[model samples]
Target: MKLICYLSLGSPSLEQSKINAQNYIDAGCDVVEVDFPAKDPYLDSPYIQSRMAEALASCDDYSEYMKTIEAIKAKNPNANFIVLTYENTIREIGISDFIDFCKRNHLKDIICVGNTHPEVRKELISNDLLISTYVQYHLIPEEVEVAQNTNGFIYLQAKSGGKYHDEYKDLKSIIRHLREDVKISNPIYCGVGISTPDDVAMVKAAGADGAFVGSTVLKLQEKPTELKEKIVALKART
Candidate 1:
């Protein structure tokens, strides 16, 4: 079973991502999902920006992003880095630019969460982007069909919006439908609200090809070494 750890480096510096990467590597995680807000409504609002770096940090700028990526790579050279972008920002930048960036980095995968075909396909869907969709919970067979049409991986979010849980009861039904009904042959990975070592076991047993754990790992800031150890333990399960 492969465990993909989501690293939300919600910080002013690249410190969180760097630490998360090192821990993820040590923990035996198969990949490290590097996420940045594609667009945050509160970024423009001073009230929230005062509290959250993801709300206040200037991570969207290309230079800052590149620097952060370099720091993360330094920490774990072999760790798979899948960049997670929100649909809005990706469409805004033009899909071509996004594809070009991923190709340049040799990323095995790149995902546009909450994105639609009409918003992206015209630009470079046929290119080698290796995209993934975030239908999350409440998926339709067509959503799986659309993702299949792109010939990319499927990102099954465990909840509505972005939330985590100990066990998502809906996941099994959704995965079963997507597999048996939609005939989705590509890889199936789950994200959202996965926060603990035990949660990892639940998803893996639910027939998920992998699980993306974010908040728990990111919050393990002061004790990255310990956090990575836990992750590695989960990776060894089953």
Candidate 2:
């Protein structure tokens, strides 16, 4: 199994997001997720917005997202980046062109939320499926069909909605069931409500092929090398 860390680019200041990504890379996270900023209005989280404002103040333009990837890859050539974000920007920017650009530049993947646009299918390479997570709820089943047809993996959310608090004691069985219900071998990764190395253990036991960590990782200190070590230790526990 592999791991993908969500790196806040659109949603977070470039500096902070890069710092967070470097931390996870150091901790042994298998992959990274680069999400767009202030995406969900319902968050109604003033505090979140406040934090986001600070992050975005220093954020780079969307075009720099790819440049940053190349820079990071130059340093950590083995690491892969997932261009995690909402789908609208893609449409605005021209999906086909972006997909071609990503492949040409060597980006690992793109994870989209709140959409399954018919046109989205043309974004990835000939056989790349648009990755979906459980955050969308009630949409996974239909989305899975898209996954099957589009060649994208079905990413499962392991925990309940909202951030993963320390209160979430154990959820291995639940993760297992989600994977089984999906009933496919096409790379299922669980995310949301995960905090700590133990959570990684639970998801692995649950039969997930990989795990996704975002806010939890951002809460961690910067330092990609060390972060990767921590991730490896946690991942091995399962």
Candidate 3:
């Protein structure tokens, strides 16, 4: 299973984010999803929100974020990078400019939190950037269509609500529904509170292509060794 780790641009520091990105790459994360610090990360939990807030306060502009991407790419040219940010940040930077920046930096995949619409979808694709969206419990026709159209893995949110901390619900049935009913051929990645090797194994057993982990990995910020160990264990399970 592909392991996707979340790292914030400004959290700790832009330089430190680069260090952590390299560390995670060395530790065996297939993709490091970098979050562009936002004033209000509506989809994130308090743990991540606080760190993003710190990052926003410390960094003067998006230059550090661009530099972080460059540094990570320098460390590993084949490293996979995904940007998980709000729409305002993308719009503030200007869609065309953002697309050009990502293209120049070799970044492609993006998860636009709090913004899932036709225009957002159209703009990303027009610039040759891939888009990703969430798949919840109730699969609406439009949601299924989005999942079918996304280039990367279909993000299967393993929870019910957008509260402080969402509980992980069993996704076997949801995955089944997506595959059988919706005919979603894109890779499915179950995430949200997926912290254990057992959780990763469960996703793999349920026919998912990978596991997306963020909060749990972020909690190990102070313990680099443990973080690597956890990632190794998670990868082994796959």
Per-candidate TM equals 0.77, 0.73, 0.89
lDDT of 1 by residue, 1-238 (tens): 5688766554544655565567677767788777555455332234223324552364556545656776667656667877766656666665676667666666657775553555464454567667776564766546655766765678887655643333434677777777877778888888777776676777777788888776666556568676867676667663
Total backbone collisions for each predicted model:
3, 20, 0
Q: Which candidate is the best by lDDT?
A: 3
By summed lDDT, the worst window of 10 consecutive residues in model 3 runs over 160-169
lDDT against the true structure, per candidate, is: 0.65, 0.59, 0.78
Candidate 3: what lDDT?
A: 0.78
Deviation (Å) of 237 in candidate 2 = 2.3
Q: Residue by residue across 1-238, what tens digits does model 2's lDDT show?
A: 7876666553444555556666777766777766555434234246445545554466535566656666666777778777655566566556776676676767645666445574564545454534553433233456545645444556666775643424322355444444465455567777766667888877787777777765655544454555566667766664
Ten-residue region with minimum lDDT total, candidate 2: 132-141
In model 3, how large is the Cα lDDT of residue 73? 86
Candidate 1 lowest-lDDT run of ten: 42-51
Q: Model 2 scores what on Cα lDDT?
A: 0.59
